[model samples]
Target chain A: MENLAIQLENVSKSFKYFQLKNVDLTLPTGQIMGFVGANGAGKSTTIRILMGLMQADSGVVKVLGHSQPENQTLVKKEVGFSSEEMKLYGAKNLAWHIDFIKSIYPQWNQAYANELLKRFDLNLEQKIKQFSKGQQIKAQLLLVLARKPKLLVLDEPTTGLDPVARHEVMAELALILRDEDRTVLFSSHNTADVEKISDQITFIDRGRILDSNDKESFFENWKKIQVELPSETLLFRHHRSIGIEQAGKLASVTTNAFTPEILTDMQKQNIKVLAVEKMSLEEIFIANVSYRRQGE
Target chain B: MNLRLNPSMIYKLTTKDFLLFRPFLVVYILICALAAGVMIAPIEGAYYLGVILVITVSIGSGIHFALTSVIIEKKENQMSFIMGLPINATDYAVSKTVGGMVVYFLNWLPMLVITLSLIYFSHLPNGLIPISILCFLQILTGVVVVLCIGVGTGSEGFTIVMVVIFNILFNLFLSVVGQLPGISEFIQGNEAVFNATFFSVFGIEILALILVLSLTLFIKSRNACFL
Candidate 1:
């Protein structure tokens, strides 16, 4: 528990229109976990709970070894929270904001803030409203990063960036998070964005986490195998496979629990194995979501 | 949980909001000073003109302050930025309420003093003081009502609507208070009278202000989720 930066067990919340069922999550320190979810998939809601902006209806929530909502003030001091819904006072410049924030957080590192000011290429004196959307996100990141927080909770940090800006933001995050002492919970709907920098990934949909694993485990365990269709097409099926796509003499079977044994098992059934293809993160997410919803 | 305010953070947040409203405050104070000057001047018809100017600007300042400083946080999507800081729901609510009340006093206090001073220093009837007190209290209460609604709902539209309603009610309050037996009989006397009618109305106004403000804070504290 001490080694964990965040822990949520059977945490649940209900609203008039939606409900987050019993949710259990854990994130060890020094890991960048991409919280991937589609729109309104409870990414932001869960993050808000972790940040102590909302109280859980039941169960436990602890961040950095402290209880939630109860210790939110203490937790908030150590956590840097940024979201698309967050905006700085547009009437004030970044410099003014920096100073205001600095006054509140005793641990605010002025030297790092100065360095980030240069690295992010933000004009300190310009009002935040005058900044382009990309610059605005960069400014938000810079403020969060310079705080030198124990954990960074970013909810959809790249939702509205253009391709180039997205690349730049991702590149900067990848570079900065190379330090193993800091932790991050980066949430987004874009699989490519999560795939780029997350050491670990947690996929959520409709208020439930579908899957959570390391990047490699996700890559290694899910696969799309190309095969030649047998005369008895209906006879080609595997217990480990979640879905299949067939076209004439060709067939592709997607398996979540992939193994060399599955390929061997397929060949014994008279289906000619062509090749085993690795699935992209996006493909795996879609297939998994589709399979889970259909099965439920 | 209790309010659990960190004094330093609350102070910073309160000051931050106050600074944001300071420029508007400067301009509004100027208008207030001009109106006060006119009220005290010996120029013909200046007192009546000054009375109208001061009353309008007094209410105007409260509405402006509530619009810009209180409701604008939620209206402009900046509440998340504030909530992201090292504070809790209670801290945000208290700081906003404190800052909002400051706006209320900035305009109302000066006008209160000016009106009371005019009756005391000049040859005007001192008995007008009770009515003057009621009028100032009405303005102060109006601002509180607006501030409470703004803080509670963070709705600019509803708060503005209430502002209009409060102004209309302010005029009606004057008519009703003028017709009260105790106030009407002694309105022109040489001595100022503080009657039961004055006490009754004053008590309710004060009670409403305190209750409304308390209710705002209570709701915010009890509702843990700010976002």
Candidate 2:
């Protein structure tokens, strides 16, 4: 069996005001793991530690079967990282940067770089400082993408892009996944993008991972059940229900473990089920975070 | 902990700095040329002032290199790009320290050689040679201190404060070195000479440079986490 592309066991880090606690994550090869989190939700910190840019204060972190901040140099050779905090050289033009990165990485693909330059509508002669934010991001992505690394760890890669640029970047990333051996792990606050492309979805908030599961199961299990309560009697809350909001005699309950037994439980309580709708990734993420934050 | 520093990686990293600061290098060369012209012309009052200018330019070039490559890189969030390469903290810290020192030495070396030539060929007292060498070592000490500040601290404000402190210490050192007994006596004498005091002060400066560079590396390794 092939080893996991990324793994973290009980990883934790502490800043002055925030603490990332017991962050456990694992992603096997050939899967894109979308690390979904709000701003300052430890996504960037996790990604940085995973990339070996920073060391975790506690716990083990292994990327591509090598330990972090120790085997970082070896791990880095095969792992391509593109982060918002990292910028292209401003004084150098895109072509110069391409050449610079090409010189450092032996696996650089000139043909693919040229294709990305055309697809991203980036001018090779333009200085990086002069490019629009979207253009700069695309240029940075091109540098990493051309290396043809075994794993790609992108942190907030689509944060500042326009809709069209985001779409193009996402499309390119999806195309990269066509290779059966390559794995991707990208962190994003934009749930739509994560939901669209990720095979595994991990939600993090307040420096804690609230939920991590396969995308299909995450969608399938989180059902927003709408019910009409009889009279003023409160219905029996199912064990799996994470959140319940009541308005007059109507109730909307969010559950992580949607099952036939949940409907049966409601039926025994004389609560008439009106409709059960699938929760969007955004909704599931929000409910999960809010529930966890309330000390659940 | 398993990572070992690669000399080739350090060279490549240093080359990147040299290429990026080529303009500054050119400016340094021109300033040295101007200093050389003044020395050759043997202008009466300009001779001593020209020496000061050349030394100042050499030291200033080092400070600028450190500020631009280290402090500014941190301020502008460019360290991420460097650390993203296939190098760990030791590689990064050592490369920057060695790179900055190499450039500083390269800039200071030519000036040192030119000044020595002037002392050897011209009518200037060779006694000034020993004293002048001690002063040049102080200049190297200053550059190393500035490099330490840049690499050891990520705070831009702290770096600025330290640089200001560097300038003040540099001026204080110049006056102190000028007032030392052997150096003072040498300035008033006619022949090249060396005394125990000259060696002591030179030795102290050399030792301080080594200590500060070590401390900088230690600090760098302690706070190696790239944001």
Candidate 3:
């Protein structure tokens, strides 16, 4: 955590009905971390703490080497935050908002802003209320991106956007993220979006971090091994096997520690390997959650 | 004050509220001008009407400013965008209170001068001066209440109810102060006398204002994320 862009150690926050307990996270500099969580999975709450907008009941939160809610102003100068709940002044035009932001941020990139306006197909003179939801989202991104912040903490930024709109926003992020020094913590329930852009991914559910690993490892380790079982009497539990479900002549095995030896071992046991299929992030997330839920 | 509190950002937020209420300020000027013209007019009963107008305008303006700047901002969920900026919670509270109270003062001071000047030069007893000043002080206290409720709690219904209740209490307070024996004896006196009762009441108002402001800042620090 010493040289990381973000770190949260044993962070705990409790509300009336929900509690985030003993959360520890670390995202090194120059990495895009996709924070994946289901609805009400403490995604926004954790991001709020990182942005210095919320205080943890007990924990250490450091962003850009400054403690949160204490060094918020100092750290916020270099952090760009955008949430789905955030909104611009509706009575004002986009140009007015641009000017207002430009006045505040000394490093405001007007040329980049102008480029974003054209790319997002947004008009400057029109009032914010006149824009559609997609346009408003693009406008928010433009404001956050144009400042060229060191860290971007986005909470469900593409939540309600259409497929095309989501693509446009994701593409914009992809283009700007070429800078090796810039880091992004993008949270979403949509695994496809996360899988497309994230170098590292973290899974959160019920206020707990279930898993965190690199994108390649997630795809590499999780697999759906379809098998042809000789009989139903066999107890199929491999050393690395997560869960096995059999339907008479065939059994499907889910594994997190998939390897070539596991297949060879299955063949020695007289089980025929029909196919070894790689798991999508979404499938792996569902399988992981279901498997975890079974333990409870 | 925390070192993280940014003065420039506070200024930007305060000025943004001012710009948003530009129409309100413009109407305030026009209303005061109309009231002034009426106060000095030769028409009978116009001065009374003008006094009522000034009081109404000041109170209404303060309530409107609080509703829009504090209550509506939260109801519309604009506080999220604001908290995204480079500002501490305490500083955000300061900006709001300063922004609302400064406008309230701008509206209050002029009416104070106009009403007191009317009493001083007119046939109304000079004894009314201290009472009038105390009434304006109470209005200032009422504004602080609105700020505490609207900014601190972010409750619109509660703030509106408080404003209405304060209006009734204002009249009761004025009548009660006017009936105090030590001050009532000089009710028709030619010169305004500064009594111990006046100072006692003034001291209480100042104490109340300070306590309310402190309470607001405390709530803001805890309620930053809630907002």
Candidate 4:
């Protein structure tokens, strides 16, 4: 297949209050990778490292085949980034920002920017401070997307946006990804967005990556199973792989390695299966965090 | 991918920045005009009008330029947006310094011409031209230093503290030395103060430019994640 567009190997960083440990992430050249994490989960930190905005205290980070913080100039030319904390000049209008970005990026697509302007329903002449929060987010996206970079790193692009605005932004991102030549890595607490557009998913918690895999495999691997156990008997008492919650004789078990063979093994132990349910991304995310916490 | 700096883009941003300061510009002009009018009055207070105007312009330009430099980026959260562009951080910092210098010069020109004309006619401060030039250079140095501190630390309180400390130290030095046993005579013996002031101002200007350049390099080498 294609070479990875972004790669991180055992990258780590530390602050007085927080630590990011051994974050390993890989995004193939033509796929959308959704970064799923709760607040304070180090998702932004990881993205920042990849963008060469922050250096890793240890390990290696490569974006588009160039080492970061050293070759950032080369990588910046091909990477488009937007973050919630970032803003345009308050005195500048959308048109001014557009022209400014156009001047710096030789690959700027005027037609696309014009289209985004119309699509976002933004007046080119109105100063940024006058725009609503959703409009501001749209304006930010327009500025980044118009540059037509090969890789787009967006941090919470839809945060604080209304449902309709979120949909519009998601739709636009999806449309951009259809080209099969561009890659996107977007971080969000909203799992639905990730579930809808991501080909690969990485879930991070407590400054460490919990899981990273294809979306389909992630879903296929995690499952919630209900089992009916005999009174005073525990089917998962000795099972290390199963996360068991027992209420009376009914036990709910969540497993990351779910399979028919595992279920059959449970049945052999005289545990009656009540239900086998597939876990959603949200459920998996919560279970992943809870599971980590339980281990701690 | 396209990677080129666009002057049109810089111009657009510069225009926007200028527009934001339009009201302040008007206020500054009014103050200059009022001070000039007051200086032309035949009164005892008119003696220091030229000096007052010079001081006003210096302080006004320094504070206004510094405030603009600090607040513009923070207000808009444009740091990331600018960093995301193809241009390096060094270029970005240089552009800002150049932009601030342009605006400062534009604001200072009117006051300078008016003050000089009035001084020429009134025969006050016989070396008004040279003194005014020296004052202008000092203020320019102040602008550069303040802007650099603002960008590097990204804190208004810190910049204010630095400015206050600088002013206090300079004034204290002047006061103590001007009263020294033979220092004052030595300083006046060969117009050393004037020559020293001119050279020091020039030295500061060059140093400011160098500091700005180094800051740009520091920004580029810094991890983007911290920013």
Report clash pairs, candidate 4: A53-B223, A53-B224, A53-B225, A54-B224, A54-B225, A87-B77, A106-B2, A107-B2
Per-candidate TM equals: 0.92, 0.90, 0.89, 0.85
Residues A119-150 of candidate 3 have per-residue lDDT tens digits of 88899999998998889988998998898898
Whole-model Cα lDDT per candidate? 0.84, 0.83, 0.84, 0.74
Better of 1 and 3 by TM-score: 1
For candidate 3, the lDDT comes to: 0.84
Measured with C-alpha atoms, the lDDT of residue A38 in candidate 4 is: 97
Top-down TM-score ranking: 1, 2, 3, 4
Sorted into a CAPRI-style docking class, model 2 comes out as: medium
Give lDDT tens digits, candidate 2, residues A1-296. 76799999999999999989999999998888999999999999998898887789999999999988677888988999988877777888998888778888999999989987887889999999999887888888889989998888889989978898788888876665664566889899999989878999999998988899999999889999999998755655678998888887899999999998898988888889999999999999998888888885
Residue-level lDDT tens digits of model 1 in B1-227:
45777778878887887777778777877887788677768888987788678778878888787777778888777888888888888888777776567655765676677677767787667888898798778887788788778878878888989998999998899889989998988878988999899899899888978887888888888866575
lDDT of 4 by residue, B2-71 (tens): 1234455455445545665666776786687678667667788775664566566566656776677565
Error of 3 at B192 (Å): 7.7
Native contact fraction (fnat) of model 2: 0.69
Going through the candidates in order, state the TM-score of chain A alone for each one.
Answer: 0.96, 0.95, 0.96, 0.94
Candidate topping TM-score: 1
What candidate 4 gets wrong by more than 4 Å, as runs, is A162-164, A175-181, A237-240, B1-34, B41-44, B47-50, B87-89, B96-99, B121-126, B166-226
Question: Model 1: how far is B9 from its true place, Å?
Answer: 2.2
Best by DockQ: 1
